[model samples]
Target: MAANKLYIGRKVRDLRQANRATQAQFAERLGISVSYLNQIENNQRPVSAGVLVALAEKFRIDLAELSGGEGDRLVSALSETLTDTLFDGYTPSLQELKLVTQNAPGFAHALIAAHRAYRHNSEQLASINDTLGRSLAAAETTPYEEVRDFFHFVDNYIGDLDMLAEALAAEIGIGDADPGPVLSGYLERHYGVRVARATQNDDLVRAYDPEARLLTLNPYLPAPTRHFQIALQIAQLHAEAVVDSVAAGAGFRTTEAYEICRIGLHNYFAGALLLPYRRFMAAAREVRHDLDLLAARFGASLEQVCHRLSTLQRPGQKGVPIFFARIDRAGNITKRHSATRLQFARFGAACPLWNAHQAFESPGRITRQLAETPDGARYLCLSMQVSRGGRGFRQPQQHYALALGCEVSYAENFIYADDMDLTNASAYDPIGISCRICERTQCASRAVPPLKGRLVIEHNMRRTIPYSIRPAGDAPQS
Candidate 1:
């Protein structure tokens, strides 16, 4: 199969930064003019075959990627939108696409907006056609989505609250020792609250009685979880003003969104308290981001470690830009944050081909995936099943898999990805955000075709997939 013209600006930029070569030096090595290199890095030009061979020979990059960078989000959306099979066999070249994005950005945005609206309207129409006089209301964003977007816009880091948590953690001397007792003592001394253990019969994980000045914790929770709960309580009580101010500044539309955002801020404070930025970052660098080692050294759970890793965007002393996600047995995404370019689907379960789905099959073992998305960006995903909050065999436990991944550009920073063959393009399992927005035309496990994709049907020619997707005016693939 012939490859289409790929816009791999981000990958090229990453490779150049990884090698620490100036543009002039890199251009000299690639045998291209500095201006041409700049255009390629900025995604204004398509890569030539000679340049591809130079990237392969000099940089060991197989030149497999699509357009991505810190450019306009509309460009990314428009690029993904154009992948619909309705476009027929004609694909705009990289230069032409760039021209559209640059010259008529509003037009590009209008096209993408139309595509998204079409998908939503199509769903509503299907529901309406199924029943007589059934009017489907206009879709509205949920409070959960509002809060998630709030966090996303903030880079999932509350600088003031994080600093406060770190300072309080230092004051309480949170080291390798048990933090539960220290945090409990701080609450007692400062707030005049009594910390006691809740009986096994108690259903609440934590209960605070203001009239009696008592804080009770369930005995069943693990030590790390107990400490986390204590830290969260402290964040609510001590950092109330800061968290409130941050939540207020986010200006969430709904009251429920504001409240949820407040809770999320408390979570950030709690995690920061458990793992101070500088201390945890030093340890993470020392261990090369080994999750187990970091967890043991910091007395944190694996899920907590993954969450903390995603928020390592501490301006100057930053760690690898990692993406973290958790999913239940039903494949519902419980938590997701991406400091990288890979975006999770806004609705529905993740793509089935993602590695997190298989993490449950092997309980304790770490599952790794060299996966590529429809945009041609690649990631190194690591996942493992985690269980928490169960009292007895009959009692229900919260079971989920936590996945930590970053682009292969930063793979060398992770110890788990040491043995991964980054140079092998065929090793990657093709995946997507979701089937509706996915651009793949030949996927055997595609739940549904691209939203507006045209399909070719034949009764006699059956293949791995029942129907093949093609451009509307193009002949069917044989």
Candidate 2:
């Protein structure tokens, strides 16, 4: 077994040397005896509380920063390294790795560097995997296939079908008072289907019956969920052309991913048609994007509200180009959509400092954080957790967080920004979008360092922070 390494002494000695002061001079500045300072630097004496306070007060540095509570930086780096395909089948539990990072950064850094090297080697070996002779075709099979085939069966365009649905609902006197029966009636009238109560078997929420040409929804689904399903079914059938047109615009290589995206886009159009963009934008502006109120007014879910927020970019009358993202506890980005220039990692996961993951700890509570990337782009993020299904303790359902944000300058428009002290930038907690897209140099939350830079760790002369680096993909290295 390897022996435990003490980093405190090395860190203390480095800090003292960087000031270019003698041991006696440093001791005098710190108001500690020369012998005591020497003992602390040599690891013979632990940094006492008084000395720690004195250092913080003298240097005007937060204790958290000095003690490296910013250890999340190391975790971010480790996660990026571990995501390498070398650990494709084997992964240390997140809790275990997090503990190591918090208590043993040097070991974590060494392990991460090794893993990254292994991943690079593995990539070289697997280079041929991309060109393997395989059919690589879309089957046009299964539920997703059925959905896509149905869209292709019709041209991909649904003009005013949403309006038609609304008109029919109004004709039938279906207001918000009783949305379920009204929506069910609207679906039956439009699609020749009847909503039937079905058991939650096979984890299916809704299924289409070919014989009756009927859509059967799970009885356990909430009212909002049911409405979304019904609306989605209508759009799938009536708005196929619109969905296909959008999917075609994407120019995807595989039909499978394209089809999935098509369904989602179609659902989005359905929601938009239900609560047209103009009215939705008006409501959002009025409420200052209060997601709960918007959700209620539009009869949409929080996820739906956030998703709609991203789509507000409609040519000339664009609303704020806020980005919306959803992530699980493991920090995997399950869903992400952005209207702004913010680039998200298409191949990897998001940065750990993103508020989307933090919302899980506080659940339902909103958190605000300001993030600056190495490139100096700043963002203000707002996040809160939301849960779906599992109301009666069957599995307690899956709960995760949703984060919405815009550039820092545009943040004040949000209601949550009202009481926030944005004047003191330091008071705002620091965060990052994802390391791959973020270029912030000094961020402790950075994972793989920016894809555009090479970090050079100077062991002989350590700074107050961990490592420094030159921007990657910049001018040729001189």
Query: Which number leads on lDDT?
Result: 1
lDDT, residue 100, model 2: 71
Please report, as a residue range, the 10-residue window in candidate 2 with the lowest summed lDDT: 149-158
lDDT of 1 by residue, 106-164 (tens): 58756765666666666677777565566444434457766875676456777898889
Candidate 2, after superposition: displacement of residue 442 in Å? Answer: 3.8
TM-score of each: 0.76, 0.61
How many clashes in each candidate? 0, 13
Report the lDDT tens digits of candidate 2 across residue range 35-95.
Answer: 9888777666667767778877775655543453123345555765654444444456545
Candidate 1 ranges beyond 4 A from true positions: 1-139, 472-478
Candidate 2 lDDT (Cα, whole model)? 0.64
